[model samples]
Target: KISAIANEYGLSVDLQTKVWQLTVGQQQRVEILKALYREVDILIMDEPTSVLTPQEVDQLFTTLRTLVDDGLTIIFITHKLDEVMQVSDRVTVLRKGKVVATILTTKTDKPSLARLMVGREVIFRLEKSRLERREKILEVNNLQALNDRGIPAIRGVSFDLFGGEILGVAGVSGNGQHELAEALTGLRKSTKGRVFLGKKDVTNSSAREMNDLNVAHIPAERIRIGVVPALSIRENLILKKYRHSPFSYGEFLDNKEIEENACRAISDYHIDAPSCETPVKLLSGGNIQKVVLARELSENPGLIVAVHPTYGLDIGATEQVRQVLLAQRERGAAT
Candidate 1:
């Protein structure tokens, strides 16, 4: 399996190295095989569905269903309510770093669990366009991109993202999805062809340059690209927005303004933290992702590059993330 993943990453490493080169999705698959190899009775998965696509997720669920039927104990730690409702017989909701609610999965809905966790009216679905949409927002033509290893990642891919569309790029691990996302958001330079934001050519724009153009990105690798673990939540929140916000008054930094923005994002995104002064690493995966999502989604950018936005999130969190993105799309943001 690692050798198979190596083919995707174009790495010459051994099976261990092959596993290292593969994406999170591929790694999950490898772990499953490893469990089988060792004849393990119990399988503990943390954010197991985070890196998988919808189809892959279904397949995994089916396999787990079979396993459960065969009397295997699978302990899954996640924040997704839908997954619990679907696959789990018993449900547990954790809040403030502790388990607050545990009950039968069949009796609990998203709202019930979410309200118990956060104490609020949780709308699982986003109101979206019931009408037609027009105009092309972003265009990619004959585009080619490479990963960090200087190997071809995206080869001759072309697509048009419309003015109000959530065009999900679904693929197995290492099918050029990450490279394509990087190219779209300017984290990586394209090897050939063009990328246009509306009609403006932005083929080789830098990350900073893309941000200047109201382009926001939800990076696939959250720990690597999204946040600095050591930084305070407030600091991380304003990391990208400081250059062009109330947080900056010309050449001076406005500490109060930064605090305000951070507070707003935290509250709105339901980030589970005691205060904005807390280090981002101290927060749970769901809360950390919420902070990142809030920062980008609240920006109301003209273009949002959401790569694996719901990765590492549970069903309820996944629904919220999807709702936020859908709401933005309905408001005519070219995502």
Candidate 2:
């Protein structure tokens, strides 16, 4: 019956696959599958299309329309104005904790909705300065890696990234993007290949070793891999650099210094929280991502490995994130 229902809804995730091994998009499909298995009449989907491919998104819209026609109700929550215009019958715009407007989706356009959500004119286009293409920062030669399921994920990958350059790896979500990022950041070991940091061969180094080498990573799974949710924002900001001077005094953490660092990050990153003492789990997804960025980019890393950095972020926050990366590039950092 489960299989039948999943097929009926066009849910195509592998039942035997481990959740960790699955891509974000596949995991999202599994979540919808879980809901379908329970036979719910109403579904609440938040950022459903964020990780999905264009084709997957279209299929999802078709499925949603079918479900609606068959007397199912869906509460779709997303920051994407176009998705709202496309999928929603009625729209409710929220800013801070208040609802700015709740009207029929057909009655309003994208521009008006954007202004309502942000309380200002929000620019969609971002201008990035030309890449300087300086010295070689990273070299991956014949890199081979396996996924969590012990299946070959990264297959003989090779690339060179230069300082002040942004290299984009384009592929479908399940096609080794995570494995490659892990291999580069030392979270996953490559079976065969030499990874060189400048001239130094640092193949299969530990994650901590990579951190010590000033390698910055913006992981796709924010809550799982990015921040420690139970900890305070202050502690998470100093997660990487806490072992060093000023942040620590022998076995004890320097509370004043930690708080000061947190204050600077909170202010600079524009993180919306009650205070630095607030737990990361309480913050929104965008704020949590800001915390991750603040921690990773603070030391001015030589090489940054970012995977879907601005996924699920609103228009304003997305623009800000891109500008920050461009600024890092301006400092001759490899991205």
Candidate 3:
């Protein structure tokens, strides 16, 4: 019966598959199937398309439309105005725990909805400088790596990124994008080929070595790999530079300098926290991402390897992250 339903909805996922093995889109499909399997009258999706690829998003929208046609009610909740415009028949604008408006999708536009939700005009487009490709910053030649299951993930991937360039690795979640990023950042070992930082062959170098080369990485799993959640924001901000002169003096940490550094980062990155002493785990996802960005991009590293940088951030946070990356590119950093 489940197979039949899955077939009907174009959901071909294996019921026996482990959650860890599934892609972000497949995980979302599983969640949708779980709800549908119960024969529910109404479905409420909160940011269902947050981590899906472009293809997965279109497939999901098709499936949702089909379900709606078959008399199922779906409440799709997301901060993305574009998604709302595409998939919703009606959109409800809520601000400060109150509904400002609930109108038909055709009756309004993204700009109108943005104004209603935020009480101000939101700019969706950004002004980017002309592209001027510079010297090669990162060169991956025939790189190969494995995933956690001891299976081949990144298979002989080769790419060259120049300074002031943003090379996007686009594929579904289960693909080797994760492993490739890890191999480049030295979080995963490559069985073959070499990675070059300019003329330096730095393949299979440790994360510390990569750091020494000034290779900044904003990991996909931000909570797990990006920041130490139990640590205070101040400590997390200085996680990379703690052993340096300003943060440390021989064997002891200079608390005053560290606090000042944290304060500066908090203000610069617009991190919303009661204080720098606040634990990172207590802050919102967007703020946590900001902390990660603050730490990674603070030094203006040569190569910025960001995997799903704005994965779970809200609209405003998402735009902020994109702008930051663009700003980095403008300064001749390769992303």
Candidate 4:
């Protein structure tokens, strides 16, 4: 029965293959097949395309339409407004545990929906003016790194980033993108070559040293590298600056200064939280991303290293993040 449902949805799976070896898209298919096998009338998917590539998202959408045609009802819960517009027949907007509006997808536009969801006017697009490229501020010379298994991941990669420019690194998963970002941010050691931050050889420097040099990093994994899950938003905001002045005195932290910073960040970044004292883990994914952005970008570093900055964000949040990056670039920060 599972095989039949899989075939009907245009899903291909190997019964002999272990679940751990399956791709993310294949795992999603398996999940759908399990629900179909149980003869459920409705299927609910939460942030289904959060980790998928463009092609994978298209494939998933095709399978969803096929299932819907076969009399299966699907409820896709996602922050991505574009996906909702493309797939949903009717859309429901919720804010702070209350239904704001329920309108037909064909009747509403992205801006209108965003306003309903955020309770304020949202900018859908950003106007980015071109800036004359400045001298190279960061340079990676034949950088190499190893993955967690001590296997070679990055090999002899080199690049130069200039002020007033955004250099985008694109590649398939496991092609050393993560390793490269980590090495550049000093989170991982380079096996060869050197990294120059404006004539300073900072290769294999500690994370603290990189931060002290005014380098900001927005990691791909928010829960793991971005913020502490167990800490409050106020506490997490001061993670990097707690030992410095204003936030600390001698060896003790200044709670009042930390709280003030958190409150200011929350307002400036438009982070939706009950209070600055709220634990970061309890906030939604989009809100957590806002916290990370607020903390990193607020520092106004000389260079910004961002990995998938808008990976799991909604259209509104994605636009905000992009604008922030653009603003940093305009301020002569190499992004």
Candidate 5:
């Protein structure tokens, strides 16, 4: 979050370096330092604990409490009910761009605060379950890929994605998971070995070819590569299938068909756009990702390559995405 603000202010130090090398508390401190270094008077942080552990969150709250005592105004943007109750002094609940309520935190608890935040009664918990086992759906054989600097990003990594399992790739960031996802999605070409998808060799396939073969991709950096910023939401929705049949009529352009398709995608994805013609650049981060996921998952693809799928999304929206993926997996889709 600080990285975005620092980029806005044109701070020169490397954000990647800070994220790669620092501890959780140290990383949060770097964000504070980046704000201070850039001479930012108003610090805005959004959903800060999405990546942090419990102990690290406590340390960060301590730091934030100290900073608040020092008279620094932090516009902490968060949807985590417990965090709001614990850290905030005064809470301002905004529902659909309007401030619904603003009250002292001392008088409120998590449930009361969440009710104000959403303007409805909300459940703030999850019910756990054990999943059933199934057959292996994907296999990676000695796959290798290079980073932009020509260094080996993923070194001989092999794994199997089962039909009815949510196999987690657990690690710190930049530990080759991003590259692995890219390689699997055919966005990043592999240099060695092959990727087998149910008896087919897809190692050297392009993203378009992979999509044709039922490979869907949700990129990690959606703002950079997922959507065209200058295009309208409707235009961006049909990007993957514009040149194909039904969306296109021989050589002549089908603007009406394109509009219909885009509207369908927007409605199916539940994109909160005022109109289909609105530019995607105006949507929030979660909404933008919703568009990408909608386009990718609509085809009921055989393989889904999700890179940080829940990043920057609210709990409800994240759960929605998770349910979609799980439903796909249950229907024999591989990840």
Candidate 6:
């Protein structure tokens, strides 16, 4: 029955596969199958494409269309204007808890919808001009690293990132991208070869050492490595510099300075939070990403190592993050 319902909704999965082993898209299909098994008339999916790739997102939309045709209504909740415009017939814009507008998708556009959601006109893209490539700011030679399972993930990798160049490492998930980023940022130990930040050899250095050298890292797993969920927004903002001056003095944290800095970052980054004292976990995924970006980029580091920086962000937040990264590069930071 489950298999029949899954097929009916254009969802197909190997019955023998465990849920843990399934891809994010497959897990979504399983969820839909479960709902169908219960004979639900309506399905509500919140940020359904948060963890999916572009191809998976398209597949999800197709499946949703099939379900809709079969008389199963789907209420798709997302902050991405493009997805809403592409997938939905009638659009409902919600700001805070109130409905701002309810109109046909064809009648509205990306810019108009963005204004309704944010209450301001937003730039969707940052204009990036070609820069003259400078000398290598960071170099990794024959690097090797092991995963948590003690299996080698990164092996014999070499790269050079020049000043004013945005080097993007593209690959599917679990393809050693995380390991490479971790190794570069000193979060994981490299078993072989070297990493040089400018003239300094920084291989196998501690994360603190990297920080001292002005190497900013926006980790892949935001909740685990980017920010502490239990900590207040103010505390998380100073996670790396809590022991430094202004934020800290004579082994004591300056609460006043920290709070003020947090407030400034919240405003500068357009982070939608009620208070700086709120726990970071209380905020939505997009807002949490904003907090991480605000803290890392505001430091004005020499080398910025960002892994999946725009992973789960909405269209507006993603554009903001990309702009910030480009701005960092324009400021002569090797990203």
Per-prediction RMSD in angstroms?
A: 4.4, 1.5, 2.0, 3.5, 5.1, 3.5
Q: Evaluated with lDDT, which candidate comes out highest?
A: 2
> What stretches of model 4 exceed 4 Å from their correct place?
1-41
C-alpha lDDT score of every prediction, in listed order: 0.79, 0.91, 0.89, 0.85, 0.74, 0.85
Best by TM-score: 2
lDDT of 2 by residue, 253-329 (tens): 99999999999999999999999999999998899999999999999999999999988998778878998998999
Residue 274 alpha-carbon offset, candidate 2, angstroms: 1.8
Error of 5 at 98 (Å): 1.3
Alpha-carbon TM-score of each model against the true structure: 0.81, 0.95, 0.92, 0.84, 0.80, 0.83
Clashes of each: 5, 0, 0, 0, 0, 0
Clashes of 5: 0
What's model 6's lDDT at 226?
91
lDDT string, candidate 3, 102-204, tens digits: 9999999988988897687766898898986799998889988888767888888998999999999999877888788889888889999999999999999
| Count of backbone collisions in candidate 3 | 0
**Across residues 1-335, which tens digit of lDDT does each residue of candidate 1 receive?**
54653343232233544555677677777777666556568988777777776677787887788767777898887666667678888877777568898898877787788788766666666567564676888999999988766778888999998877778787876788988888888888999999999899999899888988888899877787899999989989888878776888889889998888889988888887889999999987768888888777766887899888878775557777888888788877877
TM-score for predicted model 5 compared with the true structure: 0.80
User: What's model 2's TM-score?
Assistant: 0.95
Indicate the worst ten consecutive residues by lDDT in candidate 1.
5-14
Which scores better on lDDT, 1 or 2?
A: 2
Tens digits of per-residue lDDT, candidate 5, 258-278, equal 788778877877788898898
Worst 10 residues of 6 by lDDT: 20-29
lDDT of 6 at 76: 90
Candidate 6: segments with Cα more than 4 A from true spot: 1-41, 149-152, 191-193
Q: lDDT per residue, candidate 4, 20-60, as tens digits?
A: 54544456667867887898889999887776666767877
